[model samples]
Target chain A: MKSLSLKRLLVTSALLLWSLTSLASSQFTGPSRDANGNVVPTPKGEQCVEPTADMRANHMKYLLHKRDLTMYDGIRTKQHSIVACIDCHATPNEDGKIVRIHDDSNQHFCASCHAVASVKLDCFECHADRPVEAFSDADYDPVQQLDEALAHSDKPHALMNRKVQ
Target chain B: MSHLDQETDMKNTAKSSAPNKIDQYRRRFLGGSVAAVAGVAIAPGVFLQTVNAKPADQEVTANNRWGLLIDTTKCASGCSDCVSACNKEHGLREIHGPETDAQWIRKVTLKNKSTGHTINLPMMCQHCEKPPCVDVCPTGASFRRVDGIVLVDKHICIGCRYCMMACPYKARSFIHETLTDQLPHAPRGKGTVESCTLCVHKVDRGDGNTACAEACSHGAILFGDLNDRSSEISRRLATTGGRELRAELGLNLGVRYQGL
Candidate 1:
């Protein structure tokens, strides 16, 4: 009878764990969508450097790695750059105005994902979200162009004036 | 066999069966990888630059000693153009007045005690070679860059006013209040001591002139590489010997004042 009761307790605990996991899974949804049921943002490039699954799982880790590399080592590869991420992700809406990440209403790319995950984004507290220069239609990859120009050109400041297509 | 040798052997085998479709794909992959490795190996300079944190063009070296030559004779009294320009550049416009406001550069009028003559000059973080501020800082946040530009790296500054106390010029200022709408280039925060960076951002961007020098209508401020003898400031300094404030200290200030 004792052995039977112990087995029943084990079964009850398993059921409880299953219910909790189901409840947690149900609460924790994927990326949030807009009112029209479409994903809020459509980033400009064909796709990111990494696959969607990898990016979803490890985007912050990639960003942090890039940040350390750029900050300490100055290894500014075009891929995995926060600047590039902002260039692609921080697009203007139908009204032609770009929403900042600080806004309470989730509109900005970083803010949208962060708000869903309940992660506090403090990068914008010191760093600017928007790109300094307004990119034209011709300038698809300004960061890469700038990097190349900086590499070749002796006058780094002059490159700022030159329009790269 | 070594891993690289084994990999090369595999590639050679893959290349031998080049006519086969799957082997052709494998050979192509190996060839592309080999080419990529060769490319990295062939361009050592480019690879080194790619690995470096500082951009290739933005190299701050000991050879280029950046400094400012202030022509006090040309600096007109009551004209705060240089001060205003610096304030505007760094977005130090949040006017709490001189008592609390962060002053990156300031216009000072110095009077000769017995000579009955006064000279106007723009005083700032002197960018000393042997800065006392740097020596006193426990966190080593107050530092002189490679190009003789003194800056407080706010990231490591623990709000300890030792640097401010050590600074002979009283150039450093502690942010007393929370800041908002800071300029993108100059990131200033409260509880951090900041001083003139000599516009290191502008220097890094290869902007030859500082805001103060550019803004000075009277041509009082001259900014250039002091180490380069051919530089305009160096030529001027050579012609007219400049004075360092508290020359007794032997700090070897980057900022020099003529007709002081």
Candidate 2:
């Protein structure tokens, strides 16, 4: 009787440990991996204006604030522009063409994060999810070009990795 | 002096001091304002901080009332450049027939029945100060900007089409089908009402010109700040005294026709 009870306790402990491990692994899964186990390439930028952890937590707030400024004040500075985000985070498809945020087959940066968070984003319903066709020629290295263009524009930022004023 | 004489003297002194007190307050107010101005001049950043700290995020202001002066005499009968330009600017492609497709602006030809005189002019959202569309909106989706430009807030629009019915010019159009390849500047969605924003995205970007006005090779459209008495539109209106379509309505339309 004692041996059987001990065996039952061991089994319960093993089950609990297994379940906890799986939960932790699932929770810690990186965003660069897709559902099909494909490792999508991480988007390139020297550094985000804010730290990665800060951005992960407060990106939405920053976007909302910047959107109001751009919409109301006509302040189209590249620091927090949604167009700039699309330019930087757009991913290529199987055909090596840039995919938009609304594409079901492939997930772009915003869609990927939004899917993971299970958040509904209505922006692409009206606004174009992809960097416009005007920038298609420079799609090869768009992030750098966009950063450079914004840096050289009339409302220039300080530089890469600097705080956006 | 006796006690009555002393009381009277005190009353007189009090009367004299009242004006002095008011002058002191006025002096302090002026001094504080002057100091503020001096501080703004010295740093200049203080002024920027104040501008940034403004609670209301007003992108458009009433200081510049944008208006269009259309000289119908200059408009070619068959030319549709302004319409085409507006369509291209707003990404208003026709997925459906003319009955369903969105028309932000259209060229209308009117004939006088008695004289048989015909005139061709482009008709769009008159952008009236007293827009009937704005009045009938149940959801307050139709709103005018501080700058006197009226727009439909598509995000909140319920697709009721009440605004369409209320508009006198038949300007607003309802999107029937899903749209693709939409311009980044203009975001049109299905089941929402849209109209000519006067190329508001371009205007907000400080372009100070509308697509229709720019596309008019015949120089029929003149876009300017109507509030400025010296502006080109104001000067032209002063000379020609352009007629507002349906002037009896007292809508005070921003767009005026010179040769209607």
Candidate 3:
């Protein structure tokens, strides 16, 4: 009887330990890896302009303020500019192609976290998702270039034609 | 003392202070000339290098009133290079017919019925001093910048098209279809009113000229500060003169036309 009770205690503790370990590990699992278990591309910058925690909390505030300054006041300083953010964060993949922010794969830096957080990103609907260098040629016609890019993309028309709400 | 002696003494005192006053005036004149000469010598180099570029950190102020002088004689009747350049620069595409498509600038040919004389001109947003669009906008989306450039704040524009009805030039266009892959400098989304920004991005970049102005092969367009007396546009307007379209409306348009 004593042996059986000791065995039951050990089993209970083992189960509890296993469950606690699983929960802790899941907490650490970030959006760094995609559903296919591929490592997501990181930002090109060595470090963000602000500390990571601070940026995560107050990036929208900075963007909103800077946008107003740039739009109305014509203050085009690079600090906290959306163009600077896209140039650093939206990096090319192994295939040497940068993904659009609204891509369903959710591999793009902004989209990955946004997808997980269930936040709808409307900025990319009007703004360029990639740097100018990502385009094939400097003087290429934008309409033709976009058409060719869409043709090569897997979900061509559907992605480009998605209505903005 | 005798009266004559007293008067002479007073004259002597006046004579004594006269040279000192002259010397003070001379010093002031010399200092002013030196500063003026320095400004003249150094200004051209700085102006030529960075033509009308405001500092990136500084806010655009009312000190600079940007204006454009278009020579109608230089603009060809069939030529649409300016329009094409504007479209390319702003990433404007023709997804629909002329009725629905966005056009920032269009060529209008005017003919005198009695004289049989014809004139070709490129017409765009006048960028009025007191913009009717700004006044009629219920959402405060249509606004004029401090530097005299009129712009539609797309974020606040609710696609009401009130500005379109208010504008005398028919300058504003409302986007009806969904758009993607817009240029970084120019952000256009559906359900927003947009018009000729006068290349505000380039203006902000200190490029000194709009894409349309740069692409004009005949040099019909002269863009410069209307406030600056020495600017080519202002000097030419002062000498040769330019007329505002619909002058009776009294909008005081930034864009002026010559040979119309």
Indicate which candidate wins on DockQ. 3
**What's model 3's lDDT at B258?**
97
Q: Could you give candidate 3's per-residue lDDT for residues B184-203 as a string of tens digits?
A: 88989999999999999999
Task: Name the regions of candidate 1 deviating beyond 4 angstroms.
Answer: A1-88, A133-165, B1-58
Q: Write the per-residue lDDT of candidate 1 for residues B1-260, one digit (tens) a residue.
A: 43235436545532322244355346556765885687588776443222112363333445567899988899998898777678767767433457677888888888989997998888899999999999999986777765688777676789989998999999999998776545556667888999888877677656778988999999999998887767888888898889888989999999998886
Q: Work out the TM-score per prediction.
A: 0.65, 0.69, 0.76
Please give the CA lDDT of all the candidate structures: 0.69, 0.70, 0.78
Q: TM-score of A-chain in each prediction?
A: 0.57, 0.56, 0.64
Q: How many backbone clashes does candidate 1 have?
A: 2
Question: Could you give the C-alpha RMSD of every candidate to the true structure, in order shown?
Answer: 16.2, 18.9, 19.5
* Model 2: lDDT to the true structure: 0.70
Query: Candidate 2, residues B5-59: lDDT per residue as tens digits?
Result: 5336545632333364366457656765886677678875443222111223334
Which residues of candidate 2, in runs, are more than 4 Å off? A1-31, A34-44, A64-76, A91-95, A133-165, B1-58
Quality class of the docking in candidate 3, CAPRI style: incorrect
Q: For candidate 3, lDDT tens digit of each residue in A47-135?
A: 99876644654466568767777887799988889988988888887677788887777778777666654557788877888876775
Tell me which of candidates 1 and 3 scores higher on DockQ.
Answer: 3
* Tens digit per residue, CA lDDT, model 2, A1-165: 879767645644454454344345556676445444433435657787666544544465567666645543445667767777666666565456776666774367676555544567887778777765444433223234446656677864423333211
